[model samples]
Target: MNLTISVVLLAGIALAVVLRLKSATLTGAVIALLFGFYLADTDAAPTVNELVTAIADAVRGIGN
Candidate 1:
């Protein structure tokens, strides 16, 4: 559950970056989010989840 929240927070940050850069519109962000939702339902979701977990672990290890 924590990892899921982390992923969502990171994705929101990404959208904010895009907005700042003027490279993405609100519609584009909505479409991207929908795409992510669809992708998460696919078989690739596990791989993505594992990758996020690994990244989170590495960041945590860096602090310790």
Candidate 2:
């Protein structure tokens, strides 16, 4: 649960930076957000979550 929140916050910050730099338009962001919202309801969500958690764990391990 904590990892999920951290990942979300990190992604939000990255999205904000991209928006500020005008690298992605508001429409594109909105579309992507909606896509994610819908995607989370599907069976692939578990696979996605596991993938993210595994990546996060690997990143954390790098410092040790």
Candidate 3:
């Protein structure tokens, strides 16, 4: 399940890049999200923490 979502997310990125279509990328993101509840297991707090960390890191990178 996790694997499927990961694959789909990756494929969507690839599709957006290769097709140069924003809509395709959006579609892919939506698909992954829809399958997320069924395909992956998570602790709500932990997930939020991880996302915050990732966002912080991404923001920090911009200054470098």
Candidate 4:
């Protein structure tokens, strides 16, 4: 993937693991982003949905 995508993914993972802010699912959402860009021929809304799931996971993790 491109540098920007890689950076963003790592940042998300780092935040989730190191900062203990986000959740494990966040990693997948960030990676899915690459699909939206690389496969412009398809849809993009799904990625946001995946992101929402990640946010939910993060929130749940915080509670537990």
Best by TM-score: 2
Kindly list the per-residue Cα lDDT of model 2 for residues 1-64, writing each as its tens digit: 3544444455556667666778777765875585577668767799999999999999999999
Which stretches of candidate 3 lie above 4 Å from their native place? Answer: 1-42
Provide the overall lDDT of each model, using Cα atoms, as 2-decimal numbers.
0.74, 0.72, 0.60, 0.59
On TM-score, who's better, 1 or 3? 1
| Model 2 residue 4 lDDT score | 45
Q: Specify the poorest-scoring 10-residue window by lDDT in model 4.
A: 33-42
What root-mean-square deviation over C-alphas does model 4 reach?
Answer: 10.7
Q: If scored against the real structure, what TM-score would every candidate get?
A: 0.60, 0.63, 0.34, 0.33
- 55, model 4: CA deviation in Å? 0.4
RMSD of each: 11.6, 12.4, 7.1, 10.7
Per-residue accuracy of model 1 over 1-64 as CA lDDT, tens digit each: 3544445555656667776777767776784686587668768789999999999999999988
Candidates 1 and 3: which is better by lDDT?
1
Descending-lDDT candidate ranking: 1, 2, 3, 4
lDDT, candidate 4, 1-64, per-residue tens:
6554554445445555533544447555655565445444446557877988999999999978
Model 2 pairs whose backbones collide = none
Clashes of each: 0, 0, 0, 0
